[model samples]
Target chain A: MTVKQFFKSNAFKSLAVLLAIVIIAGGLLAIFNDLLFVSDEERFNRTIEKIYGGSATVEETLTITDENGTFDKGAVSAAYKMSDGNYLIHSSGKGGYGGDVYLWVVVIAENGKFGGIEKVLLDTSDGETLLGNFRDSFYENFTKHNDELVEGKYFGTSGSDVINNVVTGTTLSSNAMCNAVNTAIDFFKSAVLGEEVVSYTYLYEKYVDMTQTTIERDFAANSVTLRIVMQANGIAPSIAFDVTVKDGAITAFEATKPFVQQYDETKIDESLRNGTYFVGKTAEEIAAALPDGETLDPAKLEGLGLATGASRSSESFFRAAAFATANFEAFFAPENLTYASYVDFEQSTFTWNYTEGNEVKMHIVMQANGIAPSIAFDVTVKDGAITAFEATKPFVQQYDETKIDESLRNGTYFVGKTLEEIAAALPDGETLDPAKLGGLGLATGASRSSESFFRAAAFALSNYTFYLTGGEQA
Target chain B: MNKYVKTAVDGLITNNATFKLVLGTCATLALTTSAINGVGMGLSVTAVLLLSNVVISLLRKVIPNTVRIPAFIVIIATMVTILRMALDKFLPDLYDSMGVFLPLIVVNCIILGRAEAFASKQPVLDSAIDGVATGLGFTAALTIMGVIRELLGSGSFFGIQLWDFKIGFFTSSAGAFFVYGMCIALFTLISNRVEYAHRARKARELRVPAEGPLDAPGISAKEEA
Candidate 1:
């Protein structure tokens, strides 16, 4: 049929009717679409306030259209908010597991320090891979370091002790989040702080009741239990007190939780058998091994490990040891004259230095801040006193070059090698040794699988800290 | 009753706009996604169809044949626009759901076809009945297709769940084509059979002997005697 004849036909006439109807309907719709626009804007504002933890203003709002941007009617929009009060801000520099790096600005002000992260959202679509681990670990990191930040330190977590660092194949996402927080900090300093030369203080408060003060001295138990609560409020509310006997002789003193030095050496020695450290060694031997001179510095001892690449494994060990020592001091130290019982943090290691075989007496002290207590192990070296020696903990032994080669060439799991062991096995001309792998294990031929394992391990280690500190018993 | 009313009803049901006449296939396909949508579209078209048919019938004597097509189109457009606004304000959901199909009804072959054919020759009441009956038939056909499609494709009847169902095959665009094919095949078969039976009956009634069968027989008998 001719086109004109077809158009004039009854069937075509009906088809034309339907099309005409739809056109009219669309025109009517275009007229009322404006009414919904206002409601959508209001909903967006409320969502921003709820999600970003503050009131946000819409400086500019416009309808989304093609060729302008990628945003759609339902797509998210960007906005900014300003603080209502004074806040203390500090930066968190973290080396995420598997060589990922992150930076963040933790703000603590008004109510408390590390006032938790004001906002943490993935700004990069490419960084979506890190979402599972980074998002999971965020609140936990805040909780773990809140008090520490309040005390003026940016504590870093290592291994499973912090939140999972190697998020499900999303190292880039981790970096993006780190960058976002860093950007926020830079933005705050430049736009908010702005060359203002002023001094700020962090306030702490302690509440104490004299009527409720009780001191129990158990001579036979070689311990004392002193229960006291103190409250003080000021610009910086920390209160330091020294509890002394009536004759002015110091009995026992503690700050917040008693430090390592405040513990009675004899009582600590007696209680040594019960600590996690004495699980492998006898109490008498462990007490005897306690260095009489200054503690061995972990930073210096790291130099003794096999050198490879940049010495990441050695650095990790030193860091792990420092965190372990801090944990040891926090939980097990005595309170007042009486030695108070505390939870055993067994996931870390401790080290000290002493002279042996006439070599210059070594004094070492380790200070790792953000690893679990279980991963900690001690290594003792005496000059010419002992022949060849192995790592104090088999799990912490450094792998030799042969072991590293086997792992790299054969794709075997490098389970127990320490940084020194891995470092010694670097191939000639290779810039990075296992020590420099940054908490990642060598599975060379099986890089992908090894990377997955690293990510999983990092996640597990980070989760462990949160699980323990959540104060919930499983 | 008037012979014209009966003629229109018989024409619409037996020579239906969809089944027999096949006048408005576009509206049928475009709007038959659900029974509710099809009915709304059907009724709106029906109103415009009735009004336009009557106007065309009333003006048949006055209007010259040269401008008849243009005159019919203008009338249909005016009626469709009014209906569109009314639907938008009162039955917004249907209006939205009908979408562009609502306005497109102005060009429907069924309405304009009747205006040009029966309405232009018939009286006002007869034209109105023709419009209503034909529109009703079209509505019925579309509603049937829509109901089947919606039920099979989405497990719903008029957008309401009839039963807890999990028919995996009906959940995609493929299901829509499947339903359309089946419905077309079924409706076509039914209409063909109905039309065939109707034509066969008419043929029998109109059948005539080739050469005066009785007179030829009588002559042959006489010659044999």
Candidate 2:
């Protein structure tokens, strides 16, 4: 065919049209890509707000590599330095029942005790895994466990906590979650705290010694009982404290042991300063006042100096106080309460019946905030006196099992107390009013969890319907 | 229904790519692990479908019949590449979640089938609507299947837990086949019933014109009594 005939041929026409379309489409796509592209900084900035809820800047991103080849795809992939001087590490958690799951953990950079985790946001995960944890607010339970971390204590958890055990038939998924968190914590310890980034996996292993720390919930008083018995990494004594928390408030911040001091310590007590330390101060106040690093705020330490060579004992007291603050704020968060988890949070007193062995079938009641079907706590009342209290599977995961075991043994606080007495004793929002709580000489040691009975009492009084007779009651 | 609307409805229901036409079976069955995942895959397909249809319809007059298949494929592949990049930049989470499915859109028989059967002859407007309807139909099918699989298999609705109950069987690829089969059976059953009812209604109208024309077969009639 002639050149003119070829130009008019169908083959030539098809090639020309196809080539034209490809070029035009390519140009258009490139333009769209440019217009719609989100830089890593911008993408992280937007995602960070969904997590933290305020404006924050990305300071520096610590790239994640599968260095030791430990995890599947999860690692603290990026660390952004925020404009507000806070650090948030974006980590990925892999290996769910299905495959890979991802999340972002925000580290609250406090000066002392390795700036702990402030919030955990499950960004993207397998649908099954998310359903099992998300709707139930089970991630809150995971982050709550982080509060029990006393850097000075024996390393990190061995990873086989009971809470990790009962995460909806997906323990491997839970392990992935714990590994992701540990990755971020390790990054924080090395990058921020400047400590040796120890590599003790906190999941899929037996805790170094699970028995060393206790974070029991006082079922009777609706309080968090803390009994930390462990030797320190530094000069601090083998410290112990029975820190008490009720309704996100500290009622008892007393050191069950002596507020460790080596030699004659400069007293911040009477005749010296009014707003000094310990007795007059709340744990939250002390925690808030505590500095981020080894040094206490010079002003707060005005009269009392870390007596020369007595830094261990003094610093230990400060660290204990920080932990007490975190335990109250993190452990007793209203989200932990089953009653507060229902839609009718104010009036959510749903109950189920549980039959005791060779005994009357008693009704168990729980309070909640959101409409989630799972209630956090269940209380049993036999003949108007409380008997047994059970926190649901998800809620139980929020505290250390050893602590709950210890706290539950004090069932005497609930076994005999009337519903009214239990309600009255609940730490009045944050103030510990033992008088309202039946003022029984329950133990001289401040086990911090003394008020759990009140939670039992409050649930019973609101849910139990005795005056109406054999009616179905929660 | 007007011609444009009918074209759309036809694409969405009568000639749905994943069900009736059975095109793009692999991606439909694979990416539908969650409700949102199904939607994500569906929307991506729709975007590519719409763009490709418009281009192919626009170029139909210039391409020869003998070389049209390769020409159409080239054009479709270009659109697919552009779409893949746009999705990656704009919807990174969706991009990651979709994994390999976005690039696989090029092989989706639905796109080429429409180009060959309809776009080559239809007007640009009609082709675009066809693309949308067909994409929507594919999306609707996948999403419904995803909803069933996600809800029954994992006890979740759109990645959110309604309860902690799972059937286990629905989460597997075999489970995808089960759900897909049930959906096709259900769709065919309903369509057959509607077709049967429409024919019956037409017969009834012929028997008695006094009542009126039957227009409830998902069609709105402008006829007057």
Candidate 3:
């Protein structure tokens, strides 16, 4: 392309504009970054204030890893090599209860072996869910754990207070803190001891399942415990269970994971009977019994009711038993029933797609991109610009549905617009103010309908990164 | 509509970035847990939006259309970096609460949204007002949502615990949804009622002139006899 043509060309125009903007923006940002940046010591001292309630001197930053992998439990901050021959590290794990759990843990290094954790501070910056008596007493137990202590009391008010092997007042929230502490301990084992990390296909906080069954020869009892979590709806809250197998016979079966029941008690009483019926049955017999694919006949399930939702969940149990029987004979028995490195069940899933009847653009639905769990949306785009999305669904604070709905459908203001054009659409000669929004006294005031509109637009744009032809899915 | 009045109204409520436009959601959803936090985030955002809008309006003629998005982004980012660092040094509590979202303001759609749509086409004076107006709208929405969430979730107005009674779930994401929905509903209801009242009053005034005191020549032309 000629020099003159290049300036007019889309490629050059796009690139030149981008580069010029980058240069100017980057130069200024660098200076601000330097000026705004806090020194490591100050940052550490602040974290230490929450953790130790005293000033701490961070010696240096260090990296640790082993055979399984580097310590990937959480994001570990500076290693404060204290005067007491201890290293204080601040770490954050993604989830325990509702949000993240940040902790300050002190570890001691002994002659190249994994030293135990000395102190742990559960940073409540993002808060934790604690209710009732244990709310005050839970942290006291954590404070009781010092470096040399091996056995510590699992804090819980009652026997039923424990959830997913975590003993605490609240199941999910308190368990998150437990997981954070365990992550710190695991990091010590992997980094300091240089021990080979446990290799497994799946990992979870509550329980671990070996990819294959580890069959054991008769000793005490020729039995293996298997944990399987599944639910009817693809996005349904998972239902976790542990099925014990002894000599190819299903012995013990219980739902160990923390979850509220979807099926009523009567249905559970009737459906869970599938467990007893399958006991002493071979994997071949169990597999032979199942119809294959997503459907299984309840009549074939021996008096199990298909009308209630219990049968579907019960099928999850039988499926686990069958997989166990086959894999049991394959590896667990051959290895003399020895398996430790557990892996999680990573069930493969694909996006749910749809094409509205007689519509030009495609529509796809997915979960909303926030902590608003279970909330979902439908994104419809034509010629790359978003047409609209159904934002008032699943859950929302829709004050005026009619107005919000009207504004959402009126996204044509962004028709054929580039993502750039769509993002910035302020009117001409308008000196806008939040207070005077309704003051313009138009038919409608500051409309969240527009925000919802753009949210759908932005969501649709993001999905463009993972595109597929529009068609109906069976 | 009067152009200046319309613009200010639009910024605050008509086309608000937070409640209306839905831009800069990262900060809105993450930071608006308390009233002070909402105001703090709002000021920080206002600073960037005002400066970015002014800068972009001045450079509007110099910059090319094809590269407008990038140019706007660059300007916004610089402004955000400055705001972020300045806040970190001066207002550490707000800075700590905001965390990673401090830097994330660069990507906030509001700043760039204005730069591309308003500042680029409008004069410097108008663009500055647009920035402040929109910033205020964002601040208002956040503060209101924050107030609702904080009150219900903590049973306290602004960290002063009024009672032991608190809905712990309200402090979580699920709670945010409920509070956000309710706030939006209340905001729209009150705003619409006032707007409707104004329209009704205007219509009455117009009808009065048309009624012509019930004895004007327009209505009593034949009755003049």
Candidate 4:
């Protein structure tokens, strides 16, 4: 076609129209983009307004560096001192169930010290599928227990006692959230407040064999004081004592006032209450002082140069003393101490047994929260399909145990499904799909226990496929 | 009645974007999780639809037919981007709550569908009316669905806790489907009955005789008499 004809053709008209529209649209958008542009400072002020309920100017941009100390689970990325005396910290928590969780934390500052967490908002996250499962109250928990968090009382180094409001199904995410807030708190203490960072010595109930309510350690003096509460059998009131250990020996043993008031005064021995015979004894001597089966005969108590009137009370005292001595040594001895937070797949064990007629039985023990062994199960696989699945040790946790047990112990959830199919149901590094989990009869409410069950099943299936059937390892 | 009024009525009721035409069901289902979300999303869409329809209608004669789709998309996308910026600046809470879906308004069939089906052929005045009517229709439908779902699923109405009783099923995607299906079914039943009554009344006004039984599709016995 000629040049004149080409310019007037339908193709040229279409191209001209599209080009004109694109230029006009782009121009208009560029103008509006400038008009409605949200600058970083403006965005920060907006977030502050939303969280703090009023806008404030930036007082200073605080610097976060290695001098603040390194955090294993998370780090502080940005910090800003607000004109209203609050510090806004942008932080991220690692080791989430899915990946990292990013958060914008507003730390309330008062008189050049950490006040509390004003608010915590999720800025963005990387592949945290179950992030939406958390409610607003979950974030509010940080603000609720700000003082405890600053003192490193709740989420300590040992990770035994986390926040009470940890969501049932999202333990890893909850832990990540705790780590993120703790990072902010730690940075505020070390960098802003110029104070020594607080560290906790957590001891689990399983290892201690008694409830260590409160523990205080004096490293300079090489002594530890702990209160142990033991629930007595039947309707008798629970007994409590404040036991102090100095250089691996019990130095002081005194019953709490509540224990003294509740216990029968006539039957109790003054020597036990006053630490007459139990003082200056080690854990081994303490254990030897108590008779076998936790019952000391009155005659034996007298023969051991101890008060004989309160034999039952003496037995309780000796047992508490033994636990106190052991826990104190464990606390000071780094080799014997096992931090609950460090529990992972390495602590888990998987063993398999083969029955007659092509049936293979696998036993798996796994930890739900890395605090302790939470679940153990046996799966019988025949021809690659799970024939029988039973909970050798039923799933248990601090909360939601009954629902978790009911869901985990339901054999029909796993039976009649092939090992590969069960294994493929849960992909690696992704949060559990609630719908798929529902199809597999896993309760989303009991997510931690369900996750433990899933990990155990995956472990069993991988082992059954690789070791028994000679398949390649996953 | 005026033709413009009739067109507006048609857009609002007969060609409702959510229930009748089933356009923009993605936003309808996704954002109807709460009444406030529904209202916020609905208003955002309405703003986009109204602006895009007017602009496209004005440029219809100047733009060629072959490149209409892309041209229409450019206009709609521009409008959506502007809406997003304005919301982010003025109403950050709504912007945060709407999240990705706020930007996804560009692809919503409601805007493009009206541009091609009505705005591209109609005058500017009529297209503007149609846009408002259709937008309001979608908002109404979403609000209704939001109320039902929020009440059933979250036991709240527009974020106010009425009671703690809730059926969590209503909050899931499956629940959205269920609520959408039920809303469509109920809307169809009610609209169909109203349409039949109006047609019978019109025939009576025209003094036309029924060719079949009164209960037959459009005419009733009383109107025939």
Candidate 4 off by > 4 Å: A54-60, A65-75, A82-86, A92-102, A108-116, A122-138, A147-183, A193-474, B203-225
Put down candidate 1 lDDT per residue, A428-463, tens digits, no spaces.
322234565656555444333233222222222222
After superposition, which runs of candidate 1 have C-alpha atoms over 4 Å from their true positions? A1-474, B166-181, B195-225
Error of 3 at B96 (Å): 4.6
- What's the DockQ for every one of the candidates? 0.01, 0.12, 0.18, 0.25
Q: Which ten residues in a row have the lowest lDDT in candidate 2 chain B?
A: B216-225
Compared with the true structure, what per-residue lDDT tens digits does model 3 show for residues B96-204? Answer: 5665566778888888788878999999989999999999999888888777777776666755767777676665666666777776677778778878778766665
Least lDDT summed over 10 consecutive residues: which range in candidate 2 chain A? A201-210
Q: Rank the models by TM-score, top first.
A: 4, 3, 2, 1
DockQ ranking, high to low: 4, 3, 2, 1
Most accurate candidate by DockQ: 4
Candidate 2's docking class is: incorrect
Worst 10 residues of 3 chain A by lDDT: A336-345
Task: Give the fraction of reference interface contacts each candidate recovers.
Answer: 0.00, 0.28, 0.45, 0.53
Best by lDDT: 4
lDDT of 4 by residue, A1-474 (tens): 999999999999999989999999999999999999989878776667767676676789987786663565578888888888888888777656767777788888777877878888876554554443354657877788777665454442222234455655457777677777777777777788888874422322322213224454454467877766655623334567888899989889888756333765456667777877778887656645543324444554545544444555556666677667755655443221112122232323222222244455655545554333466667776656677777665433344556664645766677777655665656652234556564555544676666666655655554553323222232
All candidates' chain B TM-scores are 0.78, 0.90, 0.88, 0.92
CAPRI class of candidate 1 = incorrect
lDDT of 3 at A350: 17
